[model samples]
Target: MYPADLVKPMREELSVVGFKELHTSTEVDQAIKQKGTTLVVVNSVCGCAAANARPGARMSLDNEKTPDHLVTVFAGVDKDATDTARNHMVPFPPSSPSMALFKDGELVHMLERHHIEGRPADMIAQNLKQAYEQYC
Candidate 1:
């Protein structure tokens, strides 16, 4: 696991935007299962996460259409939580530094790591805003 000290600011990048940190499988399950729109961020300690994912996620919330809940689970630091979050994203492969939007307990939009790594933050935010407009 990455040191908590090292990832504190990274975690804060999302938490500062109102994302609750889900540290256990149960927490992930309960958080995502709620009614209304929920945004789950499978956060990670990677370059692209710092460069794009977190920034994009933060920017995306600026949109008028936003999820009712925002939460996150660290990929390596919270293994069970990450796995539980992935289970909600069935048919989609598990990815670090990903984003999943669930509405009424069903997965609606997913932004995998491949989509985040090479993209600019504004582009990623645009993608998320589009999803939000359609679903949230």
Candidate 2:
């Protein structure tokens, strides 16, 4: 895991935008079980994450139909939490810097690394906005 100091700003990238950070498996489980739309970001230290995913997620929240819950689990720093979060994404392979949208505890939409990589932040935001329109 990256040192807390190095990853602090990365964590802040989302927390600053109001995303609650899940640092434990129990926290991941409880957050996803909430009775409303929830956006779970699988945050990471990858270049795409810093340059695209975090920015995109922040921008996507500006949409009219934002999720009721916004949270994140850092992939490398919070391994247990990240693994538990991925468990909620069964059938979908794990991917760092990914996104999962759960509606009343059920997985609804997912944006994997392949989807985030090579995509501009605005485009990623647009994709998320579309998902928000359909599911949030």
lDDT of each: 0.94, 0.95
TM-score of model number 2: 0.98
**What are the runs in model 2 whose C-alpha is more than 4 Å off?**
none
RMSD of 1: 0.6
Model 1: colliding residue pairs: none
Q: What lDDT tens digits, residue by residue, belong to model 1 across residues 1-136?
A: 9899998999999998899999999999999999999999999999999999999999999989999999999998999999999999988899989999999999999999999999999999999999999999
- Using Cα atoms with residue i matched to residue i, what is each candidate's TM-score against the true structure? 0.98, 0.98
Candidate 1: misplaced stretches above 4 Å? none
Predict model 1's lDDT versus the native: 0.94
